[model samples]
Target: MTTSNQKPFSYIAPGAPKVVKAGGVANLDLPILNLATNESSFGASPLVEQAIKERASQPNRYPDPASTDLRNAIGETFGLDPDLITCGNGSEEVIDGIARVYARPGDEILFSEYGFLQFPILCWRTGATPVKAAGDGLKTDVDNLLAAVTEKTKLVLVANPDNPTGTYIPAAEMKRLRDNLPSHVVLVVDSAYCEYVDDPAFTDGLELVAGHDNVIVTRTFSKAWGLAGLRVGWGYGPAEMISALNLMRGIGNVNAMAQAGAVAALKDPAHVDMVRAKTDEARNKFEADLKQFGVVAVPGAANFVLVKFPTEDTNRRAIDAHRHLAAENIYVRSNEDYGLDDYLRITVGTIEECDRVIESLQRFFAA
Candidate 1:
């Protein structure tokens, strides 16, 4: 007999199918009204489709290792220098790259209580320790995050308008945390949901990146651009930080089709604006509609709402509600893994999609 000491680190991935696959019925529902993944209610822009089609015949060739054209387009669109942008397969890769470059074994990577589940996985991937600060009512708490930092904390990650919970930290508060943090720690602002933000005071952290060597802002084409399948994301930061990320990035991390599609997606601002306007309208209406059932949803600026259910014990109501929706093939996000058993995160879909849930939910809550 041989004994081995090899074990893999733990990472719970998002975007798992919400179909109840245990019993045959769980997976048998048809035409799932998916409000689970925070995918854009609208699909990709026409330009992106055309751009991808233009490059479809060249699959046999290797893509540009550095994503030069894509970076140039992003730089011009956002007024950032290409030198400051590092494109990745998705913002997830950019984030993981940051962990590999900055954090070593036994080093500490810090984030908010409900920041992103991926943060822990990234830390584990780099053999770094994960430190979490308490949140303030589902929102990232700046003071708590600042208080949790220690000398060994090499990287600090904050997801503005964070996932699952969908609560955001305003620009002033975000700045306060940055100002208070020691200069040695690198702060990563994952602004995956920034385009949906209507708050004038909210920032995607570009100003912070403008001067701070220790600050980097990560963005994605997934949510607002409706390019989740394309897996295109970029980071804007100091030249040195971008350089380090590029060094750690895999060859052709952003695929050819992804690069072409993202560039095209950027050229059409009207499509994104329409998505933003429509999402805002749907979200506001969804929130108001839930109130009729005495339910309160977290006012999230993203394209999703974290709806809370009245529970007597063991989060029974929320779990039951999830199953009830599941039976009807209407899938929304269950936050049990995020320690939010009493809440379900629902993506704001089209008016028709949103309407489907209301009647079903009324039956659950009223009964």
Candidate 2:
């Protein structure tokens, strides 16, 4: 075993999932229809386009170090105080900030078995121990996670509507977990895909942050707002937690154009509505198709489907399917490193994109 402080980072595992690497579509020298990244195929709002274009000329000016205006917009949208909000270049940055602020050497961070892959990576960067609680059929099992907590556990991350799998813990269950967790552990709910979710029973996380000092809910423009390129995400929590994350991040984290784009994206409710409707339709079609293939598709509130492979050659099948789809200008994700080597995560795309992927799978299975 390598030491944690070994050069070139012995802590972060080399050969992490291939799917996490960039260019599922871009690298495949084919026609390139990418459904791999869980990106909004509907693209950004026109308002954001106009705002970016308007701000393009002012590249020389330094962005707001405080992110004052963007913070205000986020607070207003979520009905939180500005002091309770913290913005960063991306939510990943916020994750790092949390580790820096709360974790010290030898401290442990707890997460579900299949939570966002990045949270553990952040813990490692801070020289903290990353621990996992067993997940309940890909859904975050709050009971198991709560049991995993100890005095050494300083952070607990729950990715509601968890990525790749898309399963969500209901609001009631989350409340029970939060109410039961140790006070010393800070709870982070990464709501990256929250905007696409339709269930009223789902916890928004921000509402809990309203009164709870230990709970922090983070959101992003990357998922639903189609601002993945710009990378603007924020967290809402008690004033003290937000301030601590801010102090850890220091100044000039978010740039000027990203702030402008996010502010504009907030104003365009119609775009969000349109994408949600389309995504729901696509999800229904894809789920039905997966059933015919004898694949067990997990029910999720998010915008992607996690389908388990039937054969022992799960990794090969997924890679072949991905490669074949790229030949036909379509792309999807194969989960080898999330510890589910037998499952492939397919993002919901346009009706045409969905059909292309389904067709490619049909051909792959036929052979």
Candidate 3:
């Protein structure tokens, strides 16, 4: 069944979203709303923008491979040990680094079925077998995950405020999962959307990383910090592990501009607050509107809303609605690849963007 035309490996999706390929702005035929990726609609922080502008003059020089200054900045802000942090091109690279460190042929990399898309892909690409546990109503079933682990399991990944679904397992549950896992297993808690959560029940993975050698918490400036374009993300773990990852990953991993922008973004608390407020408002409105239309909405702890439509035809309806919204300059993600064919994952945009999507949805369903 092997085909010569096929590439030996394809780690990413087939192609970009259709709307992106077409040159036109959001239209009926070419609607341009992008709720596909949960990027911050608020854009990069002003502090980051100014820093990037200032740093732009020195692009010719290679960036610091160690990223010592940025690491120190992160340590100062969060009280983390600077040596424990490893900055990467993005969280994806960090995940790749983790896979590279822990995985080999016959090693098992485990994550929830409802977890982020990249975890399994990274595992497969690194020669590790992926063992997925079924989720409970879009939330990761910690019990199932623990049951699936075996002697060959080397890594376990849990994304708090998981992607597509935006579901979270509480701090107690996390502790339970940690206790249940073997000490040799590396736990990766992806808190990419952690900044949006106000609940105290959810534990910050940073705090957990301090006590556990097996734990690594990965965070990104891509979400609430609004630095998606810059592609800056960092991983926090035991110093030895971080050192190993950096060693294998080589030097000059993070660029100067990204390092500069992330430092400024971390310093700008006001920007974080603004993004948090906007996301809360938009998510509330989007969820309420979906409920009125009889769509089943899973409880979301992140900045996006997960709504399940009535049937697989709703997938088409969602696509049609996405096209209709693009005509009105709005966009959302259809979760076909995630096995939720009847569902859509809508990122919380600004108030106006939310209104545009809501209005477009109303009109589409009405017609």
TM-score of each: 0.91, 0.89, 0.89
Higher-ranked by TM-score: 1 or 2: 1
| Maximum-TM-score candidate | 1
The per-prediction tally of clashing pairs is: 0, 1, 12
> Across residues 1-367, which tens digit of lDDT does each residue of candidate 1 receive?
0111221111124544344533545645345576777877688789998999999989998889989999999989888899899999999999989999999998999999888889999987999999999999789999999999999999999999899888899999989988988998999999999999988999998888777899999999999999988999999999999999989998889999999999999899898999998888888888889888766898778988898887654433777787777766777778878899888888888876788889878876665
Worst 10 residues of 1 by lDDT: 1-10
Candidate 1 versus the native: TM-score? 0.91
Task: Summarize candidate 3's per-residue lDDT along 147-242 as a digit string, tens digits.
Answer: 999999999999998998888988888888888899989999998999888888986678777767898999888888887768888999988899
Candidate 1's C-alpha runs over 4 A off are 1-29, 313-316
Off by over 4 Å in 3: 1-31, 312-329
Error of 1 at 50 (Å): 0.6
Clashing pairs in 1: none
